[model samples]
Target: MSTGLGWRDGRAVLSAVHGRRVHEREVVPGVEVGWLLGGPRRCIGAWLEGQDERTPCPHHAVIAADGAAVQCASCQSVDRGLALARDQILDDGRTYRLYLAWFGEGLLKVGLTAEQRGTSRLLEQGALAWTFAARGALPAVRRAELTVAASGLARERFKSRVKPDHWWEHGDVDHRRALLTDARVRAHELLRGHGVELLADHPVTDHVGVFGLTDGAPDVYRAVEALADGAVLAGRLRPPIGRHLLLDQPDDGTPLLLDTRLLTGWTLAPAAGRPSAGLALSERVRPAEPDTQEALF
Candidate 1:
């Protein structure tokens, strides 16, 4: 069945920073909230301060200048529908998104998912090995904040399409992918907040083609090599709608692609660079073993 909440009456715009701080408060009448993601940090739910944690629900629905709609699991999905509906502006001068990033330490491969409720999954083959955007760490530090805009009536535009998967399913993966083509392209067409960067690009091909190029079936190095090659050949990089890839270059021009295709873990360093605390060459790492197998990190 479809789950949803009714809109509050005459509520003002809600904004939260993206950081470790939990923004808990009541947004509109008849609606009580515990926390919202502020700054560039992921939107972590306010737990009882330490038990087995859970995602937070700010509101059943958001009513911005543009209009109103149900809150999906992630901001990225909801924002896709929003962008097609109307212009929305959050209090912090930003709208919403599915921010993603990648880190490395060696051969470990990983992936992550986020939204208004915080990280959904961080996997070593979709097997929740660890938190994607853990409370603190690498991917979190360099995470790229990406989003789409929408508001009141605008959100309604795509509600039906996004309702099925709830927030777990990206409202419009393909459409959102296209929007990421130019983060600023739809800004003029909608109302949103600041700090919005141009949408990064990812290949139009499937995950297998994009992530299957390296020794590991789903390693980020393969994804990175593919991305860098794609960027070099096509003159740009395109990140999958809900995924992230990190690429680094050594001073001498050696390139390393940090593989986060599994747990949003690891960093990419150049081949000739010294092995620091969290350093390892993509080539030196094994094909499909946990990075922890070696002292790569």
Candidate 2:
């Protein structure tokens, strides 16, 4: 197979990485060349593809879903692709996106809320962004929605200047670290107040709960994946619980930290002295029950 970075609309961004000459060609959706450089190793890559209607360069100005342009070679493309990539680029024109994940039950619900209130609540409850599920379990803010417009002509320009990394670190997006820490401290205080001992500084898997729920929740899965990645990047997490868990995997598997904390709302009082085995996607967990407290986030 010829090598290249393929955008969603079936166009290939051609370049020579090492001995490989990259060019675009057809591949299945949700799969692309993983990497183009180094050993005969390859990968199928996917990216946000869209267009830019107000492109200053006339070549890129007329946006179409599948057409490729010659002008502004670096960014020459359709309207939707530009729109998709616009959110990921920094003011310096470098493109990147924040990867985050969150663990815990109700992670998806916490991610959907628009108000910062959800974030503050999580921190106050002593939650930790310890796993991808936990990190991703937080919320995502739309790039376009966060930008402030100065004037009609300057609006797109303003958006173009916003950096993804900056937004991640200082933008309106709420990761809820402080709230989670507070929650942890409070949980600790409560534990101490009641003379309960924390069994382990960090608990390992004693129960396995398989969630096939991702069958219909791609967006939430992506956020959770990113959150997991961010936690790994931040030195807050490790890998699967043990070697047997690792050896049973497919060779190409990408396992991430799954935060059982997301199961925080599972049960306030342990089940027969331990957390219950979470149900599959079929039996959804609720935040409140007759005996369980509502989730912090």
Candidate 3:
């Protein structure tokens, strides 16, 4: 709750806004992560970024957390009006790179990111294995993304709530690699005359070590209950996958999964001496699919 900013560099850096300025802190694995839900969730405020300078919300408005977004209406307008990834604006004069990300078996999806961000976007999205496809202006890259999705080479969307179940491999690495490589190859062929610069063949980048998908992962885990005021979460955390936080409950050794979206706008307090984190753990069941209108991060 100390920061209202989103994750940067995958799970390592947690960005925040304080004193009307943005600050970033590194999040290391095995670190004790503790916080109390002190107050009702507030709007995270608006980040109105223009071409030359970034702007914060002047209103500093607040709202309830029952809705999907943690932003006020004014802030959302700015985000939806210009955010390139939202597919509202095109040709913002920014270079973009297309990528194919594999979440699980048959969960490969095509997406694009600004070239400057490199692989952090993939890490943020918790892609188990991924590779770059092409680089070009936003319009071209976006076109390729849609084309791939349309051709059934790879879809444009996947239910992220199901990603944790795919972090660990069902069997061997070769199978996953083959799947990703095959998609990348077919996608490249489809995009041959699309006017984007095709990237050379590269090995699929696996995130097992950074995401702790091997020894540190749980064969089965419990999902944390809904967010409400006064809820306290305390644990040792592994490197987060996208917005998902994997926690080790020190007292009971329960492996808990917290979807950060549940806590994005909640104000939190230090829970240093709390004997136990009074969490209502739930049996792991697949969550309902997200709304089709929801924008991809």
Candidate 4:
């Protein structure tokens, strides 16, 4: 199998699968990988080395259900320093755009990204709806992000759990559109008040169809808990929602919400039986259980 994982365009893909076959060129659509047999073999400490480099250190580390990768102790110290100096390290001479992304209901976040990447950033973030509020040089965009945060209009990140269940079940489209429009209006006014150039003409992105929730869309999975190391996940994959991959399990017919990040730094092999033997999707997969002695204390 391939040695590592990487993000292309706006999708999480496997670099290699059984037999050292490399998926270098094609974006292994979430649906494709979800249908395969295999699961996380082990967790490894991984971190981004540069703006475009992902380095997987061979150290056993804890992987979160939400797909957050935690590096080992030594790596964590280095990562902390890198994060503190991120502004200096990532300062390539490029324009950045400020955006307002809506997840669901009242969940929204304001963030900045390189102008040229466009909506790919939003797609990677799994935003249900988003609109550009302002565009400027890096410093100006950063200032606007801080201004928006200070005003309590939005933050830098929003959790995916805030999203409504079965997003397309009701009049979600129209209601979501209304919410985005209002958010956009408020964002524009706030940016303009802070002297940031308003981007009133940018189109709003609606990702209902992108996640395959549109009419006649294919079946997808919804995971309840995280996958443990050595747990084999076998199912048909659907387009991801945020960093989550929806898998349709063959045996129990249950949907699973898998964090794509868990796939990084893993070496996967095809499992032996149908339904991958003991690969049952259950809510029991948790980060860790509390100790009985600790509770008593």
Candidate 5:
């Protein structure tokens, strides 16, 4: 059954984010029905959380644009703290791998995840190119991330809409790999200079097969700025690039790149004909104009 909610374990499910493009019989059954109906028949309800709780509150309460659930202010506070402490905890309590992820030309980010997650974490972030720079205990990985950031090698995060479509098309994988390799070499030197132990060699991976890298221009269904709460979004869903969704809006033959994060704290239901609920005044923000430039590097 489709619940308007797409989040699971604090991450958006790949199928829900990609819409009809990703087919996993286990998660989404009757693919044809979903495609024919524009997307999964689901609805978004309230956002609920509890103080120091590992699970969401069962109240199913609505939330604000900033993701604060008015009905559960205490939970919201706890959620914020948990977000800050995420790096300190891992599900399996195993070694963590530190990575250098490259986006458009020169865009890089330093991140750490459980060693067992493999490429899953990278995929979730929609990294155009990435490589594992080091692996070690949590403290070591944390230190590596701090050192990389302090050395000006990369940032901790990037804007969701900053990614330009051109890089995906005209981007050269070999060139990117070369850049990553060079960065890796420099990173190792920097770590050693800081007296940090070098745990392992970097492992590189490209997202071409997973994200469908192409030179063809994407179809624009609508601009992200035009979306409003209770605005029923329906159409052919394209593979996600980073956290953005390329939706082919049926009302008008336009393609739009929507940030998946925007769907995080809302109640959503399948768009049968029109939206049945409205967003709170505080939840609405004017969307930004779509980027028309070549690249955001």
Candidate 6:
């Protein structure tokens, strides 16, 4: 069985695959979210939202550990062909909204989503704060995204690997909101020439609290950059950031971050207990270097 993590409606969900069948479970806070990896990474299979529920790969494809995509060649064509594409030209007449999502300081990006989805996209991307810039047909709203991206008002893409370093900023939400506000203002100004209907009076929505970051980041924590077979991850899960799970074990004083992307391609078994080996973790968060320590000290 292959089990993976995902976000739905501002909550964490665990989906498992056995043969061709898929099952889902909601992962709530204060619950010990535990799982043991079965073996090397394999293709998690295809996810075709509008067409069908996810299905196992007909070939049961095996993939590399650090590949850019979790799906194999066949699944990519069928699932990612046009879904969530900004370059596609479609006149299906669905309204779209352009938004600015702040991941951290200097990590703002421009994107568009269906008007009906509201802030779902922002929630799924682990945005700290977000705001809408405009609304219109798909093409027009996408154009707004490109305009802002080209103007350097916001990024067109972001890297997830750097997110954990700033995970401690929950207590400093005022700074996050300020960063989003400035980026949104620049984005709005950049899109003034576009034909889309500009949005106004919409305050930047903050998710630090929603992410269980209101209590502030822990003084120190560990992170998992990748996963291996037999790794055990068990702890009280905080609100996950997209697919990122922050597992805390107060008893041992070790907090860990495991990116669920690594969970995508492998089967997961419930661990009987915290194995002595447990999960391999990266370095701990170090305190800020004492202001570069001048010669006079």
Specify the highest-lDDT model's number: 6
Residue lDDT tens for model 3, 222-256: 78756667888778877777667877777656578
* Residue pairs whose backbone atoms clash in candidate 6: 2-267
Q: Ten-residue segment with the worst summed lDDT in candidate 5?
A: 29-38
* TM-score (all chains, Cα) for each model: 0.19, 0.18, 0.85, 0.71, 0.66, 0.87
lDDT of 6 at 142: 76
The stretch of ten residues in a row with the least summed lDDT in candidate 3 is 1-10
Per-residue lDDT tens digits of candidate 1, residues 176-288? 43433333233323323332332334232222222222222222222222111101211112222222222333343332332222211111222232321223233422244
Model 4, range 176-267, lDDT digits (tens) per residue? Answer: 67776787787777777564678877777788777666642223334444444555666666666665666666765656666555555455
* lDDT for model 4: 0.59
RMSD (CA, Å), each prediction: 21.6, 21.7, 7.3, 8.9, 8.2, 2.8
**Model 3's TM-score against the true structure:** 0.85
Worst 10-residue lDDT window, candidate 2 = 226-235
Question: What is each predicted model's overall lDDT from 0 to 1?
Answer: 0.25, 0.23, 0.72, 0.59, 0.54, 0.74
Ranking by TM-score: 6, 3, 4, 5, 1, 2
The candidate that wins on TM-score is 6
What are the per-residue Cα lDDT tens digits for candidate 6 across 182-225? 77777778878788998866788888888877765677777776
Off by over 4 Å in 1: 1-46, 54-184, 188-193, 196-199, 202-297
Candidate 6, 110: how far from true, in Å?
A: 1.2
Q: Where does candidate 2 stray beyond 4 Å?
A: 1-22, 29-36, 39-249, 255-292, 295-297
